[model samples]
Target: MIVSRSPVGEIATALAANGLILRGGFNFCDDEAAPAAGSAAPAKSVLLVGQAGAAPWPHFQRWLERQSARIVNPLDTWSCEVIGAVAQEFGARAVSPSDRPYLPFQQWAMRAEGVKPSPLGILMHPQYGLWHAYRGALLFEEEVSLPEAHAANHLCDTCVERPCLKSCPVDAYSGQGFAHEACLDHVRGPRGAPCRSGGCLDRSACPYGAEYRYPADVQAFHMAAFAAL
Candidate 1:
C-alpha cells in the first residue's frame, strides 16, 4: 500500500486529497552521514504535514498504517517522549531555543543546519506563518531522491505590515531574531496571563493560514517546554 516513487510530487498530491497539506519534503542518502552522525539509519525521506482541524493525530497514524508507511515515532511518540529519548541517547540536554515555543528535534535540526525558520518551515509559502508545527516525520526504507534544499522564500520580504514582529506584547521577536529569555519570563511569570491562556501573541498575529494554527493544548505543551528550558 505504501506507494514508493522518486517524485515526491505524486505523494504530495495524494496527501493533499486526503486533507493533509505537504508543508515540506526532503531526502537523505545512506552513503552520506547524517548532519548529526548517529547509529540510526539515515533518513531517506521526510514529509511534514499540516493536519490542523482536519484530523486527530490517531486518525493520521491509522491512515499511515494503512498506507504501510514507516513513521519515525508515530502518533504514540509524543513530543516529550521523543525529546526525552533523543536526549538520553545523544547525551545532549533538550533546550528550547525558539521565542514562540519548543519545536521538535527535526525542526531544530533544520535551524541547526542554517535553515531559516519561516511560516511552517516552507520558505516560499505565504500561508501557515509559523502557526503550524511538525506533527511527526515518516522515514521509508527504500531510497527516495528529492530536490536539493534551496534558499527560503520568506513572505517577510513582501509584507508591508510585518505584523508578526510588531504584534508581540513582549517584543519577543524582531529582525535581529528571537529573544528567548524574555519570551519565557513573559510566558511563565505574572505578565504571561494573556499569552498563557490565549496563546502566543506573535504567532497569532500572523495573517497567513490563520485556520492552520496548532490546537490550544498543543500550543500550551510547547510553551511549557520553552519555559522549562
Candidate 2:
C-alpha cells in the first residue's frame, strides 16, 4: 500500500488492523546503534507490537491454531511471520523478544514509553498496567520518522493503596523483590488453586487497567506456561 503518512504512522496503523498495536517505539541515533547483525548498523528505529487487552485474544488464538499444523513454536513463529512480512513490505527487519540475549524489550519499552518499573518489576503503563505485553518489533535500516516520546505518570506513584503490594497471600511480590521460588512452589501446591485457576491475585488486584485485563482462559494460558516452565 502507498502510505502517505510517515513510516512509523503507517506501520502502527497496519499493525492495529492485524490484531496488534504499536505499543511503543524508539529511534537509534548513529552514536547509539541498535544491536543487530549484518549491517554493522542497527535499524534506525524499533517499533513494538503487542495486544493491550483480550479483544485480540480470539484473533490470535485462531491464528495460533491455523499454524499449529506446521509450526513447532506457534506464538513465536506467528510473531516472526507477521512481523517479518510487514518488515519486508516496509523495507525493515523483523525481530522478537524470543531472540537469544533478547533485544532488551523491557528496557526499550520503558525508554520509549516514559514508564518506570512498578513494585511488580514490570513497567507500569498508566493505561494498561500489568495486563499488556511486548510481542515483537521491526527495525528499519533507514531512520523512520516517529512522534517523540512524552513524559507519562508512573501509575504506581499515585496508587496509595498499592493493592498489588499486599494482595498475594504468599507475599510473592514486594518492595524487597519477588520471591520466585516461593511463588512457584505455592502455585504448584494445593493452596495455589486461586492463583492457578484465576491468575495471580496480586496482578488482578492492581487498580489500573481492569478493563484491559485478560480473560480467564487467557490468564490460564499464561499461568499454565509459567507452571510448565
Candidate 3:
C-alpha cells in the first residue's frame, strides 16, 4: 500500500497541533543520512522539530507521563512515537537524539538555522535564547528544496558584561569549559538551593529573550534533571 507524500505546510500544521515547531530543515546532495535498514535510498533531507519555550509542554509532558507510565525510556519513546507517526504519515524516516550513533543535531542545527552554542553549551537561539530544544528530526528520501540558512546575529558577541561567565556560583562555565564535577557536586549539595529552585543563574542572566524564560517550575524540572546527571 502506497501513501501520499505530505506537503511541508501540512506537516508543519500537524506538528503545531502537538505544540512542536518545525524549526528548520535542509536538503543534502550527497545524503548526510545513511540508509535505514532494508532501504536502498538514503535520506535526502531533514526537518528539525522542537519546542520553543515552556508552556503546553508542561501540560503535554504531564499528559505524556500518564500515558508513558509503563515505558522505560519515556522521552525517547514518546519522541519516536510522535515523530515516527508523522514520518510514517508523510513518507519520511524519524530519528531522535536517543538514536544510537546519535544524529548530529548540533551540526544540523548550526547548518540549518545558523545556531551557535552559548556559554552553557546549549544552542543559543536568537529569539528563544537557551530555552529552546530540538526534540527530533524527520528524514525524507525525496530531495526537498531547502530554505536559505539563517544568519543568526551573535547576541553574545556584543554584550560587554558577559554575565553568563560570572553568574555561576561554582564558576562551572568559562574558558576552561564546563566544570562538570563542580557543577554536579554543588547542585547535589545544600548550597545549590537557589539554583535548584530557580534554574542556572548563568543561563538566566542572559538579557536576550527574557520574555521566553521558562517559569520557575519548568526551570526546576530541568535543574533536577541536570542534578540527576
Q: Highest TM-score among the candidates is held by which one? A: 2
Which of the predicted structures, 2 or 3, would earn the higher TM-score when compared with the native?
A: 2
Q: Which one wins by lDDT: 1 or 3?
A: 3
Minimum summed lDDT over a 10-residue window in model 1 is located at 90-99
- Model 1 stretches with alpha carbons more than 4 Å out: 1-24, 29-31, 35-44, 48-76, 79-116, 119-124, 145-153, 215-218
TM-score of each: 0.55, 0.90, 0.89
Better of 1 and 3 by TM-score: 3
List, residue by residue over 38-60, the lDDT tens digit for candidate 2: 26666677777877876567766
User: Residue 37 of model 1: what lDDT?
Assistant: 20
What lDDT tens digits, residue by residue, belong to model 1 across residues 104-136?
545533532223455323332334555544443
Mind giving the per-residue lDDT tens digits that candidate 3 earns over 1-229? 1124436788887787777788788777563444452156777778888888874465468657688346555556666777788888887888888788877889888888998888779888889988888889988777666568977986877879988888888999988799999999998898999899999989999888888888897788678877863
Which sections of candidate 2 miss by over 4 Å?
A: 1-5, 37-40, 68-73
| TM-score leaderboard ranking | 2, 3, 1
* Clashing residue pairs in candidate 3 (N, C-alpha, C atoms within 3 angstroms): none
- The whole-model lDDT of each prediction reads 0.51, 0.78, 0.78
Better of 1 and 2 by lDDT: 2
Weakest 10 consecutive residues of candidate 3 by summed lDDT: 30-39
Off by over 4 Å in 3: 1-6, 31-40, 68-73
Cα RMSD of predicted structure 1 = 9.3
Candidate 2 TM-score, true structure as reference: 0.90
